[model samples]
Target: MLVLNSGSSSVKYQLLDMADGRRLAGGLAERIGESGGGGRIVHTSGDGGRRERTLPFPDHAAALGAVGEELRADGLGLDSPGLAAVGHRVVHGGTRFTEPTLVTDEVLEEVRALTPLAPLHNPANVTGIETARALRPDLPQVAVFDTAFHATLPEAAARYAVDRAVADRFSVRRYGFHGTSHQYVSRAAAGLLGREPSEVNVIVLHLGNGASASAVAGGVCVETSMGMTPLEGLVMGTRSGDLDPAVVFHLSRVGGLTMDEVDDLLNRRSGLVGLCGDNDMREIVRRREEGDREAAVAFDVYVHRLRKYIGAYTAVLGRVDALVFTAGVGENSAPVRAAATAGLEGLGITVDPELNAGRGGGARLVSPPGARVPVAVVPTDEEFEIARQAFALVGRSPR
Candidate 1:
């Protein structure tokens, strides 16, 4: 199966041998719409052979065409008879799609209709899907939505406190993002605890450039940080996660800023960058170590918001058997893990300094021995999850 995660300006693809869940090939095409320069694809084969090309990729179609050509060189082209299906990581599926579905014209139209809900993501996904269909019309294409795993959220947790008539008309409600990562990490965490998913409750914090937290009770998402969009979650690299809705009105009426300007401010100019003039957590940590006051404050705010969600989700889940962290910052930042779990001993959330500070690979425990709740750093595998779901949906049993 070929898993494609198409973003606005990039397409990340992986060809997997679903029989053994091994990646056969993978590549990335970045700066898709750029001109003059900044367009490239880095393709790596299963045996670690690498090839990079710098060329003009004016759109997703062009980029994907190049990807096909590269894959052909590796004997894993889209037209290969061994290719089963194409799994797309669609960022939003609204409430209509609850599981991986075989893509069709109607499905494409429905995904297009959802553009307003995911203005920056769904269109790119549709483009990838359309391009793949054109490339191999006879092949099965599956859409594994990032929102699908959270569809299990009950009404009370999904609803927003507002006028039902107005809210329904505007489709205003919580539709958490990063469902793929949360689902994968939660299940992985359960496995790390030597328990089945149904026997464990986990709090998964996917702290990447865009961050979100999920409270999973018995393999089902009870509550998540992101709502309606990816913007209503933990503080991100450039996005202001949670803010007063009235701030939008205030910016327009009092601050003399247009809605678009305010939107850009919140979405592009806020978070760690707005707080400390730098978005990268590593740089922020480095500056903090140098006694930079702004960096220190930004780190504090970031960790404060993370800790709040950790505490909140702990309450929500009642008994969190595992507190799992994943994604770039969650998996790599030792300071972040330490700061986020600091002083939470009463809740059985304590990270051993020696283990937390040590650097290693894959999911491993960082909590003290026999701690009430184990803290672990589980790397998320959304691409593999997408491929697994897609292959399963096509009635193929993975070896």
Candidate 2:
């Protein structure tokens, strides 16, 4: 099965031969349809030799065509009869879909109806699906939602305290993002612990350019940091995670900023980059090492918010068996992990300096020996999880 993770500006594709459990091919087209239409796709084979190309890709459809050409060059094209189905990483499913769905005309329409909830993501996802379908009409296409796994969240956790009629009119509520990564990494952590998923309470921190924290009790998500949209959670590359709603009104009324400008501020000009003039973790750390006070403050602020959520989710879970970290920063930044879990000894959360910095493939515990609760770095595999569910739903694999 091949899984396609279509982002706002790129499409990441992986072709896996399930019969042999080998990745036949994979690649990505980045900076899609941008000015000058400059983009690149880096395709890799089993032996890890990468073939790269930079060319004009005016849109996602063109990008998909480029990807198809690359796969053909690698002799794993759509014509390969072994290719079962295409799995897409759709960012949101609202409350409608609880599992991966086979993409049909009706399903495509349903996804379009939910686009307002994810203005910046779902449309691009739909485009990718449509384009891929056009390229291989006979192939089964499946959509694995980023929000589907968190559909298990109860009313108390999912509800917003607004007038029911008003809220219902606008579909206002908590719809946590990163459900794919949280679900995948949390279960992987459970496996490492040698415990039944239902017996484990885990907190998963997916800290990439876009970040979220989720509290999973026994393999089910109970609470998560992201809500309604990806913009409502932890600090990100550009988006402000959480803020007072009145700030928008204030910005409009007093600061001479329009609502659109306010929206841009909150979404594109905020977060760690807005606060300290840098978004990447490595750059932030470098600035701090050079005695940049602004970067130091931003780092503290980021870790402080993360620690608070860790504490809050710990209380929500009553007892946490493990705290798992994944994504770009979560998996790579040792300092961030150390700072976020520091001073939580009372709650039995501790990270061993040596173990935390150690590396390996897949899931492994990073907590100090004798710690009451284990801290782990489980690299998230959303695409693999999406492919697994998509193939299962499409009957390409038995459930």
**Best candidate, TM-score:** 1
Clashing pairs in 1: 175-228
Report the lDDT tens digits of candidate 2 across residue range 1-399. Answer: 888988878999998876655678898899897898578888887678899999988888888888889888888887789788999999889989788888999999999999999988899899999998998899999999999888888899999899999988998999898888999899899998888899999999999999999999988999988899888978888889989899988998899898889989988899999989999988998899899999999899899989989999999999999999999999998899999999999999999889887777668888888789999999887877887787777666633
Q: Report the C-alpha displacement of residue 70, candidate 1, in angstroms.
A: 1.3
User: Against the true structure, what is each candidate's TM-score?
Assistant: 0.98, 0.96
lDDT of 1 by residue, 1-399 (tens): 999999988999999998798889999999999878678999999999999999988998899999999999988887899999999999889899989999999999999999999999999999999999998999999999999999999999999999999989888889999998999999999999999999999999999999999999999999999999888979999999999999999899999998889989999999999999999999999999999999999999999999999999988888989999999999999999999999899999999999999888988999999999999999999999999899999999788
Note the Cα lDDT for every prediction shown. 0.94, 0.89
Clashes of 1: 1
Highest lDDT against the true fold, candidate: 1
